[model samples]
Target: MRRSRRVRFLSDSDIDSGEDDDDNEDDGDGEEGSSAARRWRRRMRMKCLSCKEEYGGGDAGTCRECYEEAGETKEELKREIDDLKSKVNFLRLLSVGPGPAGTSSVTRPCFYDVVLVASDSIDSADSECVSIPAHRAVLTSRSPVFRAMLENEMEESLSGTIKISDVSYDALRAFVNYLYTAEACLDEHMACDLLVLAEKYQVRYLKTYCEKYLMSRLNWENSLPIYAFAHQHGATSLLDAALSLIMDNMDKLSKQEDYMELVEKDPRVVVELYEAYLSKQVNTAASKDPKGVSRYSFQEKRYTHDMHMNNIIEHETTNGTEDPKTVNFFI
Candidate 1:
């Protein structure tokens, strides 16, 4: 058998050359477009865990593992919040029921066993006053002062009426309510008023609550007065906060009206403030120039010597070797 001769429109080399030239440009452009489109598509897609929105890879946040962990943490926090809410509700329920409206005494709700009367003025002939009803068990459980007064069969316990001196009627009522409910609506004035009462009664929770309120509202205008009050009440947190604020504004110390007033009324307090300011300056200078001996070093030495002398005086007085009032007022 004779094979038929192959028919071709052009030679093999000619076809190959023609096809390669025509396809090269098209393939190059197509591949480039496809690669760019793939990259663009990738850049347009991402999942945000926080806002739960799609974003580009450029805007990506946490990885998959981190995102899952964050979600689990969020759920755990939600559960903890729910548990706390339940506990608060239970505690509220345990307190006594609300009595009849406008009643002078808590008669219907008989859980209250004691009466607290606020004596607005100790020296005045006629002073405004009010009575607050409370439970002995609740008061004793919350305050050591109340516990001591009632448990020791004092005059207040025998009479069934306790007179709380140097307190306003409203503050007394709020104090009693907080004793029962562990809650109080507070503004700056009320916070300060309650803080005084809390300190007098040794109610730690109420004192802390008032201190936090004062700290949150602290500023230059009130820092001096708050500092003095904190020192009087031994509110350490508020004292530190107020002192820090005062330290930061030391440049305007003498310019403040309260500073002059404090100086006039309490010269010892002013001296302590100066001592602290000097110490702060000395420490700052030492930190900036560790090797350089400056004027601050001499001032620091004097301050240290004064402080040591005051300590020795205090020690001698406490040990009955020196009169307590004979110690110098400055440190």
Candidate 2:
């Protein structure tokens, strides 16, 4: 096939390739040199705009723009690889893997085989364990972030008490299955209802997700039930966040009685409020009239009581250094 001429104006003064080839023919290495030049010209080239790294190519292949884009793609893939490695390390930290040859106490269990006992009632010595089919289904989940959030909340002792009664065995099983699997028969009501169970059981991640789902669809009319759960069940952190959100955005939450009711439910939160009230002693630029929107100040007696609470927490730690106070408090 005949090749099209390259784009450019060839002047009479410029020497043609044909003329130059004939003159260079005397040199035996000229043909090899010309072939190498042609190969270099054909290869794709690029330049990174961010780092100014020059890469290769031409119009038929890729120009500077193509090179830069390709570099970005490589960098992006490299970052992704690093992130995956980090996740792998975390999984390893969780001690999930192969079992040892001997069943002795010295022999460490594999990832799935390892049993973590938080409650003594579980009886780890006599426990029958297996990663059930439902558990396996949601093992590597898309909801790890939610799990992390729940773990954080639980670590902070921000959970309500959980109880199941007057409900079918199937519903309880399904709910437990969902907590273990994160994929057991999910629907709007199921998600909302399970939030209660999760909150009661101190399942922070599940409860937080349910709260987020509710918040995303929050309306003045529909939020009462959710608020009631947080308040009645002792979801202190969740209740506090919800109350702040309502006070800031919802007109109905501005009433002193509603907040006082929430305060009554979780008195420790009142301690936090009392602290904030102390901090706001200097900021008197804004004055409140009726809605009680200014800083919430508490009596000096409660402020001093913080010292007593601290002393008790220290004494508990001295008595037993095994578990954190928050976890011990809950259990």
What are the per-residue Cα lDDT tens digits for candidate 1 across 4-69? 112123344644553465455466577765565455344445667766766434434844565677
Residue 78 local lDDT, model 2: 96
For candidate 1, the clash count comes to 0
TM-score of model 1 (CA atoms): 0.60
Best by lDDT: 1
lDDT by residue for model 2 (214-319), tens = 6666555444445566666666565666555543443343244545444334434434443443444323323433444333343444454465446444544565
lDDT of each prediction vs. the true structure?
A: 0.71, 0.46
Model 1: CA > 4 A from native: 1-103, 121-129, 296-327
